[model samples]
Target: MIRTLLVGGAGRMGQALGEGLSALSSVDVVGLVDPHEPARLFSAPHFRSLEDVSVAVDAVVDFSRPDSVVLSADWCASHGAGLVVGTTGLSDEQRSRLERAGESVGVILAANFSLGAVLSERFAAMAAPFFDRVEIVELHHDGKVDAPSGTSLVTARAIREARERAGRVTAPEPTERFTLESARGADAGGGVRIHSVRLPGLVAHQEILFGGPGEGLTIRHDSFDRQSFVQGVALALAHVNDQPGFFSGIDHLIG
Candidate 1:
């Protein structure tokens, strides 16, 4: 059985993960680390800090804030624990720090843990070569602090890379000037535009649009609930111990 420790166990995603992991036969919750000690704890022991945990956990799953991710990674590596990271909005420098920490232990970091989201990125990359114009629209819950969802950025980057490899440049922009500042979305690599929407009812959704001569193709993925990520998280927790060093995205696990 995989002995697991969950960091940030008091948050929404963390609670969901704890509930999912509890139902799995191959896993056991060793400890929960959260700043605020929850009134009702899971089956595992609860600690306010990593230093307080007593058991030797096989892996650590993180669903905490981006600011805490690097420190958690470092603590995990130092304790000889595998890591599954789901925190988003990490700066390039923070990502580098995580990579460095991963040298001592296995690490899996992914922005969106839904399998459908991964497939959407793959489809967008596949469709990029055939079309000259592309744009992305991402919608998420209003409480999400990040402007554009990480899934959107990953999709746009993959599409851009594919288009570059196929020697296709995006079509020139039709308008040189805009009447309003928000008329056009933010610019992505290879001239792809990204639009972000924040709403109360949305969980997470993204659509990638590709325009050809006569028609247009759109690939979309919608995550109606946060529970969609639990399966992916479980998969990551199961496999993280087998791989050493830093890894990004769920594509590797899917393959």
Candidate 2:
């Protein structure tokens, strides 16, 4: 069994992880690390920080803040524990830290852990080379800290990379001026436009629209609840120790 620890144990995603992992026989939740202690009782113990953890942790599942993700990576690197990070909105330097830590221990960092979302990314990349015009619209709960959710960014990157490999040129933009400022949305490199939406009642949703000769294709994925992520996290934990390196998405782990 993988002895796992949940960082941000008091947050919604952390609590979900705690509950979900408890049901899996392959994983043993050894402890929790959260500065804000959760009122809900858990089977495992809770601590303010990783420094307070007493058990031998084989892996760590972090659904915490960006800064905390770096700390978790450092601790996992030092303690020889594999890490599965679900936190988003990480800066370039923070991502670099995780990459460096991955050199010493296994690290799986992903923006969205929903299997459907990963599949959507895959589908978008597969369809990218067939079309010249593509745009992305990502919607999330208003409470989400980042615009153009990480999943959208990853999707855009995948689309760009796939088109590059196929030697397809980026779609041309005809608009030289806009009546309203920021009307065309942000360009996420390779001429892919991304529009971000935030509002109440939205969990997570994204759609990639592709336009071609006389036909248009749309790829969409929606995450209605936090539980959508549990399975992917569990899958990552099950295979993280298989190697010592950085995995940016769960796609590589999926069969």
Candidate 3:
């Protein structure tokens, strides 16, 4: 049985995870650590700090802020607990810190946990060989702080690597100088342009456009709800302890 401790248990993603974990007989909600105490009691004890918990948890799942992930990673390492992190917008330094922590215990980090999104990334990379021009557009809810979603960055990087391995160079830059800096979206790997959209009533979505000589291909993935991520999180929690290192995507768990 997997006994899990969830940090940021009061947040939206945390609540969804709590309910999902509670439904599994093989899993137990060992404890919850949330600074903003939940209004009602949970199936497990709620504590303000990891130090307050007396139980031995098999894993720690964090849906907290980026700033809190490093601390949680350290705590997990010290306690010999597996970690699954879903927080986004971490700086390069923070990511390095998490990687170091993973040396001691299993750690899995993902920006978007939707299974379809993971497949979309793989498909895009595979299609990169036939396409000469490519661009990525990622859309998310307005509340998301990051401009370009982490999923977009990952996809672009994968596509760039695949193209490089195929010995294909990106098309030359179109504009020597731009009247406005924002005229073109951010430049990602291999000069692939990335456009970000933030709007109300949107969950998470991304599209990869590939252009060849006579035809074009577009691959897209849309996450309509947070429930799309629950299964991925559950899978990570169930198997994280088996691997003792840093893992980046759900593709690794997808067989």
Candidate 4:
């Protein structure tokens, strides 16, 4: 069994993960790190920081703030433990830190952990080379801090790479002038436009629209509840120790 330390153990996702992993016997929650008072969500000991943990940690699962992820990476690297990061809105430098940890132990960082979301990204990449125009629309709850989301950015990059490998140029940029600044959504590289929406009712959803002569295709994935991520997280944890390096997507684990 993997003796795991869960960061952000008091947050919604952390609590949910604690509850979910309790049902499985492969992972044991050895400790929790959260600033919130009395992090009673789990039976494990709670600490304000990773530096306070005294027990042996075989692996770490981080769903905490972007700043906290760096600490988790460093601890995992120093402790010789595998790491699975689910935190979003990380800066380039923060990502580099996480990648550095992989040099010593297994590390998997994924933008979205829903199985359907991974498949949707794959489908979008497969169809990218055939389309002349492509755009993305991602909707999330208002509590989310990121604008376009890390998922959309990764998806855009995947689409861009797929098209490039096929020797296809990006969609043509529109010449029409806009009356308002930032009218058209943020450009996600490779001429792929991403429109972000934050609403109270939405959970997590994305639509990839592709257009060609006389026809269009739309590939969409939705996560109506946070539980949708449990399966993918479980899959990642199971294989995190198999290969000792950073994996940017869960697609590497999925068949």
Choose the strongest candidate by lDDT.
2
lDDT for each of the candidates? 0.87, 0.92, 0.87, 0.89
Structural RMSD, model 3: 1.7
Model 2, span 165-249: residue lDDT tens: 9999987897999999889999999989999999999989999999998999999899898888989999999888888999899
Pairs clashing within candidate 1: none
> Each model's RMSD to truth, in Å?
1.4, 1.3, 1.7, 1.5
Q: Quick one: best TM-score, which candidate?
A: 2
Prediction 3 TM-score vs. true: 0.93
| Superposition-based RMSD of candidate 1 using all C-alpha atoms, in angstroms | 1.4
Task: Give a tens-digit lDDT track for model 4, residues 98-142.
Answer: 999999999999999999999999999999999999999999999
Clashing pairs for predicted structure model 3, backbone only: none
Mind sharing the TM-score for model 2?
0.96
| Residue 105, candidate 3: alpha-carbon lDDT | 92
Clashing pairs in 2: none
lDDT (Cα, tens digit) per residue for candidate 3, span 1-255: 888998988877788778877777777888888888864445788989877878989999998989889989999899999999999999999998889888999999998788899899999999998888999999998888887889999999999999999999888877889899877899996969999999999989999999888999999999887778878888898788986899997788998
Instruction: After superposing candidate 3 on the true structure, give the runs of residues whose Cα lies further than 4 Å from its correct spot.
Output: 39-42
What does candidate 1's lDDT look like per residue over 101-130, in tens digits? 788889999988999999889988898999
TM-score of each: 0.95, 0.96, 0.93, 0.94
Better of 1 and 2 by TM-score: 2
